[model samples]
Every structure is written in C-alpha cells, then in structure tokens.
Target chain A: MPRPAVEFWFEFASTYSYLSVMRIERVAEAAGVEVAWKPFLLGPVFLALGWNDSPFNIYPPKGRYMWRDLERLAMKEGLPFHRPSRFPRNGLLAARVALVGVEAGWVAPFARAVMTANFAEDREIGEAAVIEDILRALGLPADEVMARAQADANKLALRCQTERAAELGLFGAPSFRVGEELFWGNDRLEDALAWACAGAA
Target chain B: MPRPAVEFWFEFASTYSYLSVMRIERVAEAAGVEVAWKPFLLGPVFLALGWNDSPFNIYPPKGRYMWRDLERLAMKEGLPFHRPSRFPRNGLLAARVALVGVEAGWVAPFARAVMTANFAEDREIGEAAVIEDILRALGLPADEVMARAQADANKLALRCQTERAAELGLFGAPSFRVGEELFWGNDRLEDALAWACAGAA
Candidate 1:
C-alpha cells in the first residue's frame, strides 16, 4: 500500500507560508504522513484575481491586523519573526531554486532557509547573492545549484507549477492537497494531515 | 477584580461565524475566560473596502473553497450544517434581535440559535418570522423582543456596534478582542482565550 501523502503548495514571500514551512515536516512526521514539497509563485495567482499587490498590502486594516496576528502566532509557535522591510518581495528566483531542490531531495530545508531569510532575518531572497548565501549555508553546491536554478528550464518549470496550483483552485499559500481536498492557510496543516491519515476528515 | 474576558465580534451572515458562535462558550469556559458577545455587521465593513458583496461571492475561488472548508470544519466539530440556498441572507433582523439579547442577558444562546438556523437548518435568518421563531424557542416573548429589537434605539445600537467594529480595524467576522489586541477567525478563538488569561501573549 502506498503511504498517504499531501501536496504542500507554498510561496516564499507569504507570511502565512513562513509559518507552515517552518513546521510542516514535524507535523507531517508526527502524523505518519508523506509530503510532496511544491514551490510556486502567488504573484500570478493574485494578478489573475486583479490584485496588483498582496491583498494584505491592498487592504490597510486587514494588513494592520495580520502583522499583529502573525506576531502572536509566531510567538505561540516558538518561532522567530521580524516584519519584512518590504512587502511581497519577488520570490521568482527563490521559487525557481526551490524547484531545483524539489528534484534533488533538499527542498524542505532550502525552503525553510529562504523563508527564515525573508521573514525572520530581514534578508532579501529575491537576489542571487542572498539565495547563493542560503545555498552555501546548507552545504550544497552553490555554483551548480544556482546555475540550474536560474536556467530557462527551471524557470519554466516553476511557472508550470504555479499554473498547476491555479488549476487546483489554490488562492493562497501554505495550502495542502490530499487527493481532491484542498486546505488553505497555516492553521489547516493539522487538519490536512488528519485528512491524509484518515482519507476523510 | 473583573473576570478576564474577551470580546467576540461576529456577524450573523458569516459562514465562519456559525462555527465560532456554536463553540466559543465551551472553549472560553475551558480556559477559565469570560466572553462578551458582540453582534456586529460585516456588510458595512466590506462596503468600506469597496466590496458590495461577500468577498466569497466576489472572489469565486475563495468562495468555492469556503463552503467546502466550512462543511469539513462543521463536521469535525460535530456541528450540523446545510448549504444555505442564499449566499448571505440579510442578517439585519437577526443582528438587531441579538442586540436586544445582549442587554437582556440571553445573547449567547440567542446567537447560537440564530447561527444554527442560518447555517444548519437553512432558515432565512433575515426574516422576522424566522428570528421570532428562534426567539420564542428560547422561551422569550417573541412579540415584545421583536418590538424592542426593532425599536429605533436598538437599531441605532447595532449601527454603532458595527461602526465600532470598523473603528477597531475589523475587516472580517469571528473576531476576538483582548483589550487592544484583536484576533481574527475561529481558529484564533483559543489563542484569544489564552490572551485573556495571560494578559499578554
């Protein structure tokens, strides 16, 4: 019998995604479930919804509340957080690199490092230098991975993955897919794991 | 000393509100916290954001996911649920009656009944007849409560409460306020209760 699994769809720049990326592995392992890491861009998804910017930035009141809510949630989860100096930093390069990690079996740690850089360490994950630093810190071949990550094929692959997310009816990141069921937000991680284990929840 | 309490701001028309309304009391009591029931309107709050309809209705994908998510959540909690034929039945009348209950000290039960009627029974919560039936089921004088709920003073109170919701920077329902900190969504209910108990989190 195949191990029950879930597809984790995440974007590097999403605050909520930061929460899930930081903890999904532990949660899934505890639930005895398997995970397929999927790195995708939310920019195209939001653009298709006619949003030129992150909805958090577009709606001020919601944006205000979200920052405070994220802070509280991070504290509760024992995670470090620093508000990003910039909102919705371009995740195109980081996502493409994550796509490279996906094939090489190191996506989870790489995604966590990138998320920590963007959300907790106040570093820009959009530039090659920052991403290269993350790659080297992971003791991976920075030169080789960076070359493949920036290649046209890897870039195209990230775009296709994003398109697949759209086709799956994803509107937000840190989303989980178990069969046809889709669970959105960092809060639903546990529920998605339960669905994965039980096949119905 | 006053019992540590959190203010629950909710709207009768909201699907997520149905989940919170039914479960808040049990959760709060378990945490040794008190709950102050707040019945407010989301229509005006959304209107201020230039949304004339429910964000779910305006955004097709989010709307599509919400109904399914709500069903799963309801099932998990052992709460009865049926998809309402109408997306957002005018919650005006129900909210007004809830305001009356707030003063009369029956708001919690009243809110739960209305929520059940709206989400579980597929009743039209907007109509006086449906609301009146709920009121009578609670053993209240339907005629007197309806009269008072519709009185100009009570109507003004609901308006002021909604304005307060906006002033407090609420863009959504099932919100909990612990003094200055505001927690949004039913998922945050437990966290909000913790804040009430700890005073800071």
Candidate 2:
C-alpha cells in the first residue's frame, strides 16, 4: 500500500513557512507520512484579497506582533531566526528554483537552505546569485538548474500550481492539505499530519 | 509573592475567543495562574485599521476558512459549536453587562455564558433580552445589572477598556498579555500561561 501523504503548501516569504520548512521533514518522517513540498507565491493570492503586499506589512500592529511572536516561537523550537531586513523579500526566483529542486528530488534541502538564508541570514532571495550559491552548495548544477527554472514552461507550471492553491481556498501559509482537508498556519502542522496518518478515515 | 497573573483580552464576538473561554479557567487553575477576564470590543480596533466590520467579514476566503477551522477545533476540544447566523454579532451590550458581572463577582460564568450562547447555541448576543437571560440564569439581578450596564458611566468604561487594548497593540481577540509580552490566538493560551508563571524571567 502507498504511504499516506500530505501536501505542504508554503510561500518562501512567509515567516510561518520558514518555521514549517525547517522541521516538517523530521516530523513527517517520524509519523511515517510522505510529504510533498509544494512551493507557491502568496503575492497573487494577496492581490486577489486587494492586498499589494504581505498583510503583516500592510498592518503595522499585526506586523509588530508577528515578529515578536516569531522570535518567541523560534526560541521555543530551538531554531535560529532573525527578522529579515526586508519584509516579504521577493520570493519569485527562489520559488521558481524550488520547482526545479522538486523535479530533481532535492526539494527539501534546497528549500530549507533558501529559507535559512532569507530569514536567518538576511540574504536577498530574489537575486540569482543567492539562489545559485545555494544550489552549488548542494552539489547540484546551478547554471543548468537556473536556466531550466526560468524557462517559459516552468514559469507557467508555477502559475498553474498557485491557481490550484487558490482553488483550494488557501489565503495563507504554511498550509497543509490531506485529501480534501486544508489546515492553515504553522501551528496546524501536527493536526494535519495526524489527519493524514489516519488515512482520512 | 502573589500567584502569577495574566490578562486575557477578548472580544465577545470572536470565534476563537469562544474556544478560549470554554476551558481557560480549568487550565489556569491547574497551572497555578490567575486570569483576569477583560471583555473588550474588536469593532473599534478594526475601525482604527480602516475596516468597518470584522476582518473575517471583509476577507471572504479567510472568513470561510475560519468557520471550518472553528468547527474542527471545537470538535477536537470536545466542545459543542454552532455557526452563528450573524458574523460578529454586536458584543457591545454583552461587554457592558460583563463589567457589571465583574463588579458582582460573577464575571467568569457570565462571560462563558455569553460565549456559549453565541457559539454553541447560535443565539443573537446583541439583544438585551438574550443578555438578560444569561444574567438571570446565573442567579444575578438581571434588570438592575442591565440598567447599570446601560448607564453613561458604564458605557464609557467599556469604551476605555477597548482603547486600552488598542494601546497595548492588540489587533485581535483571545490575546493574552503578561507584562510586555503579548500572545495572540487560542493556540498560544498554554504558552501565555507558562510565560506568566515564569514571572517574565
């Protein structure tokens, strides 16, 4: 029989996504569940809600609370987290490169490295050099991967993937999906995995 | 030293607040913590953010996900939950009467009753009769309490409490505060209590 699977829908620029990406593999593996790393942009989803940027940026108080909350949560989780110099740094290039990783079976490490660089190290994820360095560090072919990720076909594939997220009624990340059930935010990770392990019964 | 205390800032109309209200006292008692229930309005807070109504109402997709999430969470918590016919039924009257309950030393039960009526029973909390019913059921003087709750002085007090919440940078309901630290959402209840017990060290 096939292992129970859960789709982890995340946006690279989402703080909560950073938390989920850093630890999902360990938890899913322990629970004997398979995880599919689905990278998608929250920009378009926010635009559909009449927001031009992360809601955390659009609302000052929420933004302040979010950073403090992240700091506390990261400390509790024993993870290194630094408030990025730029809020919602463009994840366009990183997300596209993530798709390339997904196809090559290296999505987990590449995605975690990107998140660590953007959030913990305050690097610009949108820059090609940053992404290429991450790829090269993983012993992957950087130039070839970048070229493939930038292709019209790969770009269209990412767009279609985001549309699927919208169709599933997702407005935030990191969201978890098992069959028809959708769980939003990093806090719901365990519940989603448990549901997946239950085989949707 | 006195038992560690935490202020639970909540709005009567918040769905997550319903979840928190149902079980906070038990958990707080077991954790050797003191909880001060502060009933405040979210309407003013949303207004400050240029929203005329609940953000859940303004954002349709979010609103949709919230109800489903509430249902699943409530079920898991062994709490009965019904989707109220109205979204964010005006908690103005309820908040005011709750202050009267606070004075009479019936705050906890009165506040929990209001939440139960709105969420588990699908009742309209905005109506005076409903408030009267809840107050009377608790063996409190319904007419006198309602009259006092309507007085200009009492109304002003509730308004001031809501303003205090905003001053503290609270942007939503079911938020817990321990000194300078603020924990938002129902998921953080235990963490907030733990922080309070740790005495801000």
Candidate 3:
C-alpha cells in the first residue's frame, strides 16, 4: 500500500522553510510517506495579528539567537546558510509565482529553488526577474506563468490559503500537516514524517 | 591557560533547557569550557513583550509541534520526555532558589535535578514541597536555602540579570553567553562551548 500523503506548507521567505525544502524529500522517503507542497504567504497572516514585521526582528534576542542557531543547524545538516540582509522581504511575487507552479505540478522543485536562492544563495526572490529566471531554469514558461501569477484569481487563492492556515492554528512558516496533526519548524520535519507514516499504517 | 567561563542561562519551565542541562556537562568538558548557571524568570520577559502567556500556548500550532518535536528529540538524545499537564507553570520560586544555589556553588546539579523532575519525572517544580524534597535529597539545607532565595538582594539580582539578558538580545531560555557571544536553544550548546574555548585561546 502507498503511504498517506502529508502536506508541507511553506512560505518562500521563511528561513526555516529553506532548510525543510532542502531535506523533506529524503526524509519523507526514509519515513515511507508522500508529501504535497503547499506554498502560501505568511505576510497576510502577520497582518491579521496587526504586525507589520517578523516577530523575530521585533525581538532582538530571539532574532540574534535564531541566526546563530540557524548557522549551527545548517552546519549540522551540511547545508549552506547565509543570513539574508533583508528579512521579511516582500514575498508577494514569490507567493504568487509559487501558486502558478503548484497549479502546473512544479511546486516542490520551484519552491525549493526559490527558497535556496533566498536563504542559501542570498538572492533577491522578491524581484519578478529573479523568479522569472528561476521558472525558466526549471523549463517552465516564464512569461506565461508570471502573467498568470499576477491574475486576480491566483492572488485571491493565495489569500484564501492564508486564511485556511490561520483557521488551522498556523501562526508561522514551515508548518507541516499530517491529516489533522500540525507540526511547525524545520526541526520537526522528521517527527512529522514519522507521524504521517504511522498514521498511514 | 584555562578556558574562559561561559554562562548557561536557563529557566525551570523550559523544555529545551532540560535537554541542554542534561548534556551540557559532557559537551563543555570536551570543549574545555567552564559553565556558570544563570537562572531567571521568563514571566516578566513575556510581560514586557505584552504577551499574557507563553507564545507557544497562544499559538497552538507552535505549541503542539514543540511538544511533539521535543518528544522525538528527547528519544533521539536518549532522554525521557512526557508533556506535563500544567505548562507555563510558576517558575519564579524555582528561579529564586536557583539564585541561592548559584551563590552556594551548587547551581549546576540543582538545575539538572529540577529539570529532570519537571521533564523526565513529570513532577511539578513549582510546588514548594517538590523543590524542597529535591534539595533535601541532595543533602542541602532546603529550608534555609529557600528562605535566602526570598531575600530582597537575591530578588533584585534576578531582575538585573533578566534585564541584562534582554539587553544582550535573549528571547528564550537555554541561552549561553560567552563574553559577547550569545547562543540560544539546547541544540547550540556544543557550538557555544566551542566558541567559549576559542575565545579563551
């Protein structure tokens, strides 16, 4: 029997998601679970809380420790981690583009590439040109996908997804949903995958 | 030359600290770094941020994931972990008592014992009897130490230390400070110890 599928909800601008995106495939495979990529924006969710920025940035100590912790965790995982100069960057374009890719069945790879470019490579994922180049590199129609990503329906779907995330008690990025069980952060991916496999059994 | 001393700031109610407290001794030994235990209340720090409860509790997704992830991490680290019925328990008394222990040079053992009682034994560290029993078991003067813990000077000292933590940009428990470097979370203990040893060199 095939293992049950777990949804990996992520935001393009989230640092932890960058780590999750890099490792989810192998980890899920080892745990004998399938994964579905769900790309959404956290900015709208933060806005609903009446916050204009990342909570990490507002709390310096958490922010400082987070950066250092990321460096250490990345080293342990053998992944590249470069602290981005601008955090909580405008992920609007990235989110929209991710929606288009999800619709085109290229969400996982596109999301991973975008996240690596932003967190690991320190590239500006906010810029349309950067996202377009990434889409093209993935052998997708860059101009056509970019045009569809800017459509009213795609933007509205992204908003609806954000609302769904909030309703499901999600308050951060890099959250995974194994049926009704919600696991947050990159560190919890292994456990979430295990839980999903167990549930399938 | 001896390695420079590193401060291991912790809270009794923090789950991550339990893991750190359990493994810090061996890790610090390998890195040739000394550890000074610093205990303080996270309640006041939360209040300062205008939050009435633990951010994890307020954010259900994060909270649920934290508990589950902690379980997996504990198992992997060969430690016991079970979610306590009462969370965000009053850690003030424990913190104050830790202050007295620090002054008496029994902070490390006391901190470890308290953490084990809370996370492993699933006992309430907030209860006076539980704490007293722990101290008495260690052949310490429980009553006298508890009394000294309430002294005005000790209380003030805890406040000042917390303020210093805030100034240093700490937002959570299980943080380590080596000179000006700050490392957060149980996972960063190894790196923090290495940093301390390097600084001493």
- Writing each residue's lDDT as its tens digit, candidate 2 over B57-102 gives 8999899989999999999999999899888899999999988777
User: Candidate 2, residues A125-179: lDDT per residue as tens digits?
Assistant: 9899999999999999999999999999999999999999999999999999998
**Residue pairs with backbone atoms closer than 3 Å in model 1 (clashes):** none
Q: For residues A63-155, what per-residue lDDT tens digits would candidate 1 score against the true structure?
A: 999899899889989999999999889999999999999999999999999999999999988989999999999999999998999899988
**In angstroms, how far off is A46's CA in candidate 2?**
0.3
Better of 1 and 3 by lDDT: 1
Worst 10 residues of 1 chain A by lDDT: A192-201
Clashes of each: 0, 0, 1
* Rank list by DockQ: 2, 1, 3
Candidates by lDDT, descending order? 2, 1, 3
**Model 2 bad stretches (over 4 Å):** none
| lDDT minimum window of 10 residues, candidate 3 chain B | B56-65
Native interface contacts retained, candidate 3: 0.71
Better of 2 and 3 by DockQ: 2
Chain B TM-scores of the candidates: 0.97, 0.97, 0.94
- For model 2, the local distance difference test gives 0.92
lDDT of 1 at A148: 97
Model 1 per-residue lDDT at A81: 97
